[model samples]
Structures are given as C-alpha cells and as structure tokens.
Target: MRITNRMLSNNAIRNINRNLENMARAQEQMSSGKRVNRPSDDPIVVARILAFKTSIAANDQYQKNMEDAKGWVDASESALGMATSTLQRARELAVYGANGTMPKESMQALGKEVDQLIDEMKQIANTSYGGRYLFGGSRTTEAPFVDNTGNDKNVKPVIYNGNEANLEWEIAPQVKITVNENGQQIFVDAIDTNTGNKIGIFDLLKKLSNALNSGDYSGVEDTLSQFDQAIDHILDIRASLGAMSNRLEMSLSRLGDTQISLTQTMSKLEDVDLAKATIEYKNYENVYLASLATSAKALQPSLIDYLS
Candidate 1:
C-alpha cells in the first residue's frame, strides 16, 4: 500500500482532535460530578433526570402545603382551647347567679364577671395568626366575628360576617385537607331544643347579664339549662378541632414518607456513583494520555531508525 504525507498528516490531526474531544468530555463529567450535562450526552439518562427533577419539585410543594396546613390547624386549636375555658367559667358563674340565696349585690358582681368572659370569648373567636383570622373558615383575610355596632362595649355582640366555606389544601394526589373551621357553626347557630330558636353562647351570656341586673333569680334559673347547652356546644367545637388536628398530623406523617421516597428515587435516577465514576474517569484519563503519546511518536520523523 502507498501512503502519502498529506494522508498521514490528515489522519494524525483527525485522531488527535478525537482524543482531545473525549478528554474534554471526561474532564467535564469529573468537574461537574454529572454523567449527563446536556441531553446530547445521553438522551435516555437526561430524560430520566428531568422526570426525577419534576417529581422532586412536586414533592417539595406538597411538603410546603402540609406545613402551612399544620400551622393553621395549630392556631385554630389554641383559640378553640381558650374559647372552651371561657365557656366553662361562664357556666360556673351562671350557676352561682341562679342561687336565690345569693344577694343581689353578689349576683350583680357575678354579672360583671360573666360579661368580661363574653368579651374574652369574642377575642378568642376573633383570633388571628399571620394576619389571617384563625377561626374565620375560608375567610382568612377577614375577621370572622365583628361587633354589630363596631364598638368595644358591643364587642360581645359579635356577628358571623364570614362564610361557612372550608379552606382546602392538597397534600398529595387525591388527598386534601380542610385547614379551617367555621366560627358560625362553632359559636353561633346553636339550637336550644326547648325554645326551637337558635341561641348562641353570646346570647346566653347576655341573658344571664340581664337577669342578674334585674335581680331576677328565677329568670337566671330558667336560663341555667341554656348554660348546659352552651357547655355542650363548647365540647362539640373542641372535638371538631381535635379531629382536624389529628387529620393534619396524619397528613404530615404520610407527606414525610412520600418526600423520603421521592428523594430516594431522585437520588437513584440522577446521583453519581462516586466509586464507578472515579474508575471510569481514570480509564478515560489513561486513554487520553496514551492517545497523546502515540500521536507524538507517529508525527515525529525517524528516518535513521527506520534505515537501521
């Protein structure tokens, strides 16, 4: 076979360029600690990495929703607890005021305390967290209960201005959580079976105050049964809050497990195996060095050695 200098030089240049390209690719992989920097590196691996990244991002969002749901539930539970305590205290005062043996002065003094408790309960019902009403159901941006006349003295005369909508948060596929409680249902619209009228806790407190101020012990006795109803109302609200707290805790646990699984799957898809990557990188380095040495030798003139 006849070989020309033009052919030899062209082949040498081609081989050197190929070897340098491979060396550059290996160096990039090593420096970035990634086997696939671009889709052209490995189309199949790039696709898998993209899918894993998407899943990771979705899982992150779900986790954030879970955290927000937990916070809202926690704040609601605390407010409900305070409201429950206020109801219990009001019930005690109602019982004390119902006693005919108690003097009018004492009954009037108890009315003052009951009125104070009414104000306290209103405060709890209007509790806000992060500039959002905790007990306002879906109306997080607005106050749940506002005084009818918008005055401090009439604060006990609160109205349910918020709607009975449930704030929903998605924790996973097909899994959602109600992150709010309706104050109207919890505090207002409580039915008194004896009168067939909806008598709320605030109304009962107001009646008690009126009865004590009039020195009507019998009227206080008649409203005593309503106090029991109010107690039951508080219990029911607390139970509902407890159930929601439990659901939130369960969702948090499941979300954590899902996040862990997603992390593992993402790692498997995109993370580099250091031991295998190091071995492959070393092999590519050796090949690149060998190619460089061979090209040098091939390009050198050796007429004396060839003749000998």
Candidate 2:
C-alpha cells in the first residue's frame, strides 16, 4: 500500500507527541525523586505507601506514650526513695524513744523532729508533676493526701483520697501498659487478714507520734515494728516502679527498631533508584530530541530533495 504525504505527516506528529509526553513524565520522576507521583502511576504501590504512612503515624504516637510513661515512672521512683529515707529516720527516733533512761524533755524534742519528718512525708505523698499528682493514681487533678484537721491529733493525720485505678495507655494494637500506680494499695498497709482492718504508713506514724508525746515507752516497741513493716511496704513499691521503668525503656528501644524498619520499607516502596532513573530519563530525552528533529525535517519542503 502506498502512503500519502498527509498520512506520513500525521504519523510523524503523533510519534513526536508521544515521545515528548514520555520525556516530560521522566523529568517529573527525576525531579520528585519518586517512582509513583500519583496513584494512577502504580495503584498497588500507592496502596502500600498509604499503609506504611499509617504505620509510621501509629508508631510515632506509641513513642510519645512511652516517653510520658517514663516520666511518670521516674517521678514515682524519686518519691518512693524520699519516703524510704524518711521512714528510716522515724525508725531511729522510735528506737531512741523506746529507752526509759531518756528524759521527758529529750523525748519531746525527738517528737518535734518526728513531726518534721511527718511533714516531709506528707510533701512526698502530695508530690505533683506538670500540675498532676504523681501518687494520686487516677485522681491526678487533686492532692493525694489531705489533712482534714490541723491539731496535733491530726498532725500526722492524712487521708489517702486517691482510688485504686491504674492509669493505662495503649502502645500498640491490642497492647496496653499501666502508666500510673494506685497510691492507696502501694503506700497504705494491707487489710489485716485476721481482723480485716486497714492500716497505712500514716497510721503507724500517727501512733508513734502519740506514744512519744504521752511518754509511753511500752507502746514504742510495737510502733517501731510497724514502722519497719511500712519501710518494707514502700521498698516493694519502689521495686515495682523500677521494673516498670525497665519495661518502658525496652519498649522504647523496640519502637526505635520498628521505626527504622518502617522507614526502610517506605523508601523501598516509594523512592526512585537514582542511577536507573537517570539513565531512563536520558533515553527519553534522546527520543524526544530525535522526534523533534525528524518532524522538523518532514515539515521542510524541497523539490530536489523530494525528487531524490
């Protein structure tokens, strides 16, 4: 079949347009450094990128939760340490007060110091971080311990108003971690197994203070025993807080690894191979230039060249 001049010109124009379009697309890919600029470029790859983005966002939130948990754990550990020291001081005073040879004035002086320690303990119990109580459990907005009356009868008197609720945060899908501990259970004494009566650190301190003021050396021995038990209770809570800190650190490390892996996967799915893309872009550019040159030659008119 013989081809007409108009048909030849039309075919040449079509070829030039197709080559130019390819060159433009290649340039765009190279400039953006992405394999797929739009979903239409590769629907499957686009979907995968979307999923990776979601995973990254979720991981970021988990990391933030881990940070907040770490802060809370640190605060708890510090407060517990202070309480332990205060209890040890109180124990020493109790032992001194137990001696009958000590004068009444000396015992009163010791009582004053005990009163100071009690104040310090109350301060620790009411410790707050970022305007929220560290030992308040779920009642973070309010003080954990409140002194209803200011009298000496209520001097060491403080009530644990916090609940037993454990504050929790979700670190990942189906994974939750307790970020806050219940102050009532940890700082207060366990309910007596025999009598079912509740006792706490404050209750023991109150008894000790009363015994010292009344010059009752007989009750001093039992009060010292209770003080020892309170120390042990606080130590156990500190151990638990330390364990929680360790867990959060491990979780943070794992999350860092996960984020690294996700970033690599996202790069593989979306990032352009610079070396290969450069070569492809060059090839497209050559084709575009050749098509333009050919079209220019086809559009030119020469009678001698046509005859030849």
Candidate 3:
C-alpha cells in the first residue's frame, strides 16, 4: 500500500504528542520532587505512599501523647516529693511533742505548727498541672483534698473528694500507662503494712494536733510509728511513679525509631530522584524536537508534487 502525505504527517504528530507528554511528566517530577504526582502516575506506588504518610502521621500523634504523659509524670513526682518532705518535718515535731517534760505552751505551739502543716499538705494534694489536679484521678478539674478542719477538733476535718482511679495514656499501639495518682491512693488510704492499720498521714496529723493541744503525752508518743509508716507509703508511691516515667522515656525512644524507619519508607515510595528525572526529561525533549523537524520535512513533500 502506498503511504499518503496525510497519513505520514498524522503519525509524526501523534509520536510528538506522546513524547511531549513524557517530557512534561519528567519535568513535573523534577520540580515537584515526587515521583507520583497523581494517582494515574502509578496507582500502586501512590497507594503505598499514602499508607506510609498516614502511618507516619499517626505515629507523630502517639509521640505527642508520650510527651504529655511525661509532663504529667514529672508533675506528680514533684508533688509527691514535697508531700514526703512535709511529712518528715511533721515527724520531727511529733518526736518533740511526745516528750513528757514538754510544757503545755510548747505543746500548743507545736500543735499550731502541725495545723499549718495540714494546710500545706492539703495544698500539696491539690497540686495542679495545666489547670488540672494531678492527684484527683478523673476529677482533675476539682480539688481532691478539702481542708475543713476549721479549728474544730470535735467536728469536720480534711477530706479526700476524689476516687481511686487511674488515668492512662496510650503511648504505643496497644500499650497504655498510668499518668496520674489519685488522692485516695497517695494521701488517704495508705495502709500500715506492719499492723494492717489503714491510717493515712492526714488522719495521723489531726490526731496528733488534738493530742498536743490537750497535752496527751501518750497519744503524741503513739504517733511516731504511724508517721513513719505513712512516710514509707509515700515513698512506695513515688517509686512507682518513677518507674512509669522511665517506661515512658523508653516508649518515646521506640516511637522515634519507628518514625525514622517510616519516614525513610515514605521517601522511597514517593520522593523523586532528581538526577534521573532530569536526564529523562532531556531525552524526551530531544526526541520531541527531532520528531518536529522530521515531520516538517516529510509533510513538506505534499500531494501537489504527484499532481505536478
């Protein structure tokens, strides 16, 4: 079959169009720095890239949660430390108040000091972080320990309003950790392991205050062992908080490692090789230019030549 000038021109134009499209794709990849701009570029690779991006984003949020939990743990630890020291000071006062030779005025003065310590301990129990109580469990917005002692030994006293519940943070895929200690656990319900007595440090303080005021030497002396027991309980809780903090640090490290690995995988899936893309674009551009020149010369010999 004889080839017509129309047919030859149409074929060359079609080849040039395809070459132009290829060059455009290469240029886009070079400028955008992505191998796949649209889904049609390579559907499978695009899908995988999207998945990688989503995983990376979720991992980032988990990392944020880890940071938040760390702050909570630090705040709780500081508060517990303060409470422990306050108890120690009260113990020293108790030792003095327990002496039979102490004058009534001296006992009253110590009683006043113990009362002040009760207020201080209440403040510690109500420690807040980011406007939320650190020891209130889920009732973070409310004060856990309310001081209603009101100088009335016969009536109302300090009370813990919060329940014993754990507030947890999700630090990993399925792993969760406690970030706050409830008031009941730390201040109210601490038990004496040696005697099975459920006397808390706050209750011990109230009893000691009354004993000092009345010059009840026996009652005051009886408090030293209980105070020591309460101190030990606080130490135990503080140790647990420290252990959780260390675990959270490990989770943060693991998250960082996972994020790095995911980032590299995403780059492999979507990031363009500039050197390779630029070379390909030049190759397609040259082919398109050559096709244009060839088509111009081939179509120039028109049907009019045969007629002539």
Which candidate wins on lDDT? 3
| TM-score for each of the candidates | 0.89, 0.90, 0.92
Candidate 3 lDDT over residue span 1-308, tens digit each: 99977788789989989999999999999999999999999999999999999898888989999899999998999999999999999999889998999999999999999999988998999999889899888998899888665666333367888888889888777878878888887887875635675766778888888899999999898889888888889998899889988989998998899999999988988999999998999999999899888888877865687894
Ranking by TM-score: 3, 2, 1
Candidate order, lDDT descending: 3, 2, 1
Residue pairs whose backbone atoms clash in candidate 2: none
In the predicted model 1, the residue pairs found to clash are none
**Candidates' C-alpha lDDT:** 0.78, 0.84, 0.87
lDDT of 2 by residue, 17-136 (tens): 888888888888889999899999999999999999999999999999888888988898898899999999999999999999988888888888887887898899888877889878
Predicted structure 1, TM vs. truth: 0.89
Give candidate 3's whole-model lDDT. Answer: 0.87
lDDT of 1 at 295: 71
After superposition, the stretches of candidate 2 with alpha carbons farther than 4 Å from their true spots are 150-156, 190-196, 302-308
TM-score of 3: 0.92
Best by TM-score: 3
Off by over 4 Å in 3: 149-156, 193-197, 305-308
